[model samples]
Target: MNGSAGAIEGCYWQADRETREVSPALSGDIKVDVAVIGGGFTGLAAAYHLKVADPGLEIAILEAETAGFGASGRNAGFVMTLFGASVSMMKALHGKERVRQAHQYMVSAISALEAMIGEHAIDCDYERTGFLKIATAPAYISLIQDEIELFQSLGIEGFEWLDRDQLAARIRSPVFLGASWEPGCGLLNPVKWLNALRRLACANGARLFEGTRVSEVQRENGRYRLTCDH
Candidate 1:
């Protein structure tokens, strides 16, 4: 594929806007206190948080392409509290307490994200429209009920079972039998949110290098050295 093809191919988010200017690649050896591999949501958020915690820490984010060029820019932006495969699966695998903790963490994370967006004035078209895990079959109704019951059992509120009529009132969908409605959920434009994060990380003194692919990393005299493609 040619340059810009990856950005245009599968990412509707990137394709919707004008092409973004990529940051310059690494030209020579550089040193930093921390070297972040990718420039996706996780990396950008980590860099931002680290800088906020310690403004003197030197951080660098190296990305193969531009920031948000990967799944960060190309995902259905559903900011819900569903961890792992399902609530039941999480409970089965990690027990009830862990599931509850996970749910609470996700809730806190969503709230923090919303607060950050407001504080930074990030224009990502964020909307707390809630989430609906709709049940299309009668059997799935029982599953939804079980999930809601599990949430209640775990002391996790903000979730309710919406019957067919109630769900239809919210959304005129004939195929939906019922849905697990979580009022704390939200949606946003992923690419826009990522771009905002990129800007915030840079503004907070996080150096970001696009088109810089890390080829190898080695420990040298108790410190780390990264080799990147030229």
Candidate 2:
């Protein structure tokens, strides 16, 4: 996994990050059923889920630096029920039904994240206060309406159009024309969240290596040999 030149550093999220006992660097060669090449949100989440499903599975997560030393630790912690782009844009690309399914999946993901937090007792200050997608331009009203209609077609309900007056009642914004509010979204402390997940992964038999960089993974006899720097 020659993905980077060296270990990445923690950005602004370090202020919110909780200190913990650190894992040692990779020194000698080792083998496992699975070797995750990164220690960010993606890698740790994969390890945690895999171990949960199959407790006996041997897994290891390798990080160039400490876990959450990349974008995963540095991101704004909004667990939004959004599909990256707006519902209208998604409907235009993949049509109504497909976009609806995609949107529904994101909604489900919000709850799943909540459940996972409680399940592991990961206290990252999670809040299900929901999300608001607002439109400042008058022309954007039609697009916001399209979002509501798209969800209605999916037999799903929870989205509502909030006029400027209604929006201001919640958040006082000067340029807001209208907005779409969904109640299933959330926010959290990203660094704390990742660390909790990492702890769970470790407790579930997923070995973690910090300050260890894997430069390549070579396949030999159907087994992977990870080249590393301790």
Candidate 3:
């Protein structure tokens, strides 16, 4: 690390094409049916969907920086199905039924996202490269095997186990003893995708404000009042 992490570029997603579109800052007070607090993936997705669901709905997104300046812009572009830990971990905490539901939900989310991108003709680099949860040590091999067993026991499709040779065929790595391969995954440029989503939201009639930092949010008479630095 030659330079400070903060000083380094947020991500390589923006390297190919620097500078996407940016919205203007909030100038004065305004009102809307819905006021979204951030311009990242969650906020932009909400604004986009709300407009699509009800074309007449009024929605606004407020952000202190550009649309993709937050966490959504800086993540490694891997749209994966697993979250936090293995499927067995999910079953332990939330039970087998809940795990099934959650897994289905996440899988559907990826599908919906891909559909959205396709429908909107977003040109963000999206590769259908499924992810592999590889085991680095011998101890982890048993963990991977157990995860595969859980996947089978739960009748979860699209998940399979790969032996060392099979794993090497996909990704040549000396440390990989085995790996769990799931087809429900993809690679993408998150920042580029965010910018495209921002543009799409704007085109769908969602008002976006940039460089407007929200300092406090309060509920006043059943409505939210947001104090900000505009």
Candidate 4:
């Protein structure tokens, strides 16, 4: 890639023509019932949800950079339900029912994203092509099978285990022992989705700041105070 290669790389949450602009910096001191630190998905999601739950609630978000500058925007946008934590690990940590609920939560987050896309009419190239996790070795086959069984026991369905022949038809990787395809997973442009969300949130009365960094967070007199570095 050339140093001066292209126009600014696209971001999922940069203010767009149709979207109202979020303030890029915080000015003088302000007071709010709740002050959230960090501007990524969790912070923004919390702020948005808080306001949605009760619009009269006072909420503020302190972001260190443009909202999507963190892991939320830099990610490849594969929202996975069966990607990270293993079933055994979760069951050990939170028991089977809680783990299952946790898995459902992750899946629900994806569903929420889809719902937001529809409600806001965000044109972020979102799709539900489904995500495939392929096992690259024979030794890993059992692990894949185990996950399938766990999903089944939880009353989750539509996860298919593809054998070598079936895998070869879609992916040319020769070393893949098999693949597991989950029907409800897929990818999207993270930047587009985020920007659209930022816009929608702002329209619905959420204040977002870009190019601002938070230096410290403190609780004072039963309220959270966020100090920004400007």
What TM-score does candidate 3 reach? 0.92
lDDT of 4 by residue, 115-210 (tens): 988887888888897877789877788898888887788776768998889888888777887888887886887767666656665666777655
Q: Estimate the overall C-alpha local distance difference test score of candidate 2.
A: 0.82
Q: Counting only residues 3 or more apart in sequence or on different chains, how many pairs clash (N, Cα, C under 3 Å) in candidate 3? A: 0
Model 3: runs farther than 4 Å from truth?
A: 1-8
Better by lDDT, candidate 2 or 1: 1
Model 2 Cα lDDT, one tens digit per residue, 1-230: 22332223445656544456668878887878889998998999999999989998999899887888787878889998766576667777888778767777887888788888887788888988788888989878888888687778767688999999999999997999889998778889888888888888998999998888899878899888999985
Sort the candidates on lDDT, descending order: 1, 3, 2, 4
lDDT of 4: 0.71
> How far does residue 184 in candidate 3 sit from its true spot (Å)?
2.3
For candidate 1, what is the TM-score? 0.95
- Which has the greatest TM-score? 1
Give the lDDT of residue 59 in candidate 2.
93
For model 3, what is the alpha-carbon lDDT of residue 120?
A: 80
Q: In model 1, where is the ten-residue run with the lowest total lDDT? A: 1-10
lDDT of 3 by residue, 66-147 (tens): 6777888889989988765767777888888888888888899899989988988888889889989899999999988888
Whole-model lDDT, model 3: 0.83
Which residue pairs clash within candidate 1? none
lDDT of each: 0.88, 0.82, 0.83, 0.71
